[model samples]
Target: MPVIVVEVMPKPELLDPQGKAVAGALHRLGISDISGVRIGKRFEVTVDEVTDAVLAEVTKLADDMFSNSVIEDVVSISVHPAPASA
Candidate 1:
């Protein structure tokens, strides 16, 4: 099996409430230098293989099911080869 990791994040122009809250909390804790934060999602999936067709399907799924099409974007999909022991 190949391990696939999909990362989704809010568009840079969009406001992230969770990220803002975290930044605010950090500021109150005397972390002023850290001015911003952006919250995101990561999905890890294991598949039998890594191929062009699989990548395309994964992109579609990411757009339709895993991420908010309007405000979020899929950053990347990392594929790791299966372990020999498995």
Candidate 2:
């Protein structure tokens, strides 16, 4: 099996509510210097192959199921080969 890693995040100009909330909590906890916190999603998928066609299909799935292109971005799409027998 192969593994696909997907990192999804908001565009630079988009607002991140979850990140803002965490930043606020950090500030209340005495970490007032923290700023520009952004939240994102990471997905690891196990598949039987890691070919261009497969990756393209997965990318489509990510666009449809995992992210909204209007305000979100995909940082990376990486495929790792499965580990060999021990």
Candidate 3:
């Protein structure tokens, strides 16, 4: 099986309270390298194989179910080969 990785995140213009809170805490802890943080969600969907048609379908699914087209954006959709069988 192949796995499809879907990532959804708030639009850059959208307010991310959780990410801001985490970033503030990190800054208070002296983690200064991080300037900003945006919270997001990831999903791993397993499929029988990776093909163009399958990818197209997955895109549709991502647009329909995985992401909120109004407030969030679909960050990425990538296919990974399943782990080798022992």
Candidate 4:
């Protein structure tokens, strides 16, 4: 099995209201030292086989079908192979 990790975030030019809200809440909770807060999402996928080609395909799919390029950015796509039996 291979694991795929997808990280999605808003573009730097776009404003993230949800992120701002979370940051404000964190500040109210006495964590005021943090700044430049931005929110993002992560997705993990498990497949039988995942190669560079597969990652490219999936990235294209996500960019075209799932992510909105105007507001969202695909940060990274990482693939890790399963451990072999001893």
What TM-score quantifies how close candidate 1 is to the native fold? Answer: 0.87
The residue ranges of model 1 lying beyond 4 angstroms of the native Cα positions read none
* Candidate 2 local lDDT, 1-86, one digit each (tens): 88999999999787799999898889889996787588999999888888888899999988888888998988888887888861
Question: lDDT: which is higher, 1 or 4?
Answer: 1
| Residue-by-residue lDDT tens digits, candidate 1, 3-83 | 888999999998999999999999999987898999999998877898998888887898899998799999987888898
User: Candidate 1 overall Cα lDDT vs. reference?
Assistant: 0.90
Model 2 CA deviation exceeding 4 Å by range: none
Relative to the true structure, candidate 4 has a C-alpha RMSD (angstroms) of 2.0
Best by lDDT: 3
Error of 3 at 45 (Å): 0.4
C-alpha lDDT (0 to 100) for residue 54 of candidate 4:
83
Model 4 stretches astray by more than 4 angstroms: none
Candidate 2 similarity to native, TM-score: 0.84
lDDT of 3 by residue, 10-64 (tens): 9889899999999999999999999988899999999998999999999999999
- Quick one: how many clashes does candidate 4 have? 0
Candidate with more favorable, higher TM-score: 1 or 4: 1
**Tens-place lDDT digits, model 4, residues 1-86:** 77888888999788999889998999899996898589888878777688777887788877886678888998988887787861
Q: Residue 26 CA error for candidate 1 (Å)?
A: 0.5
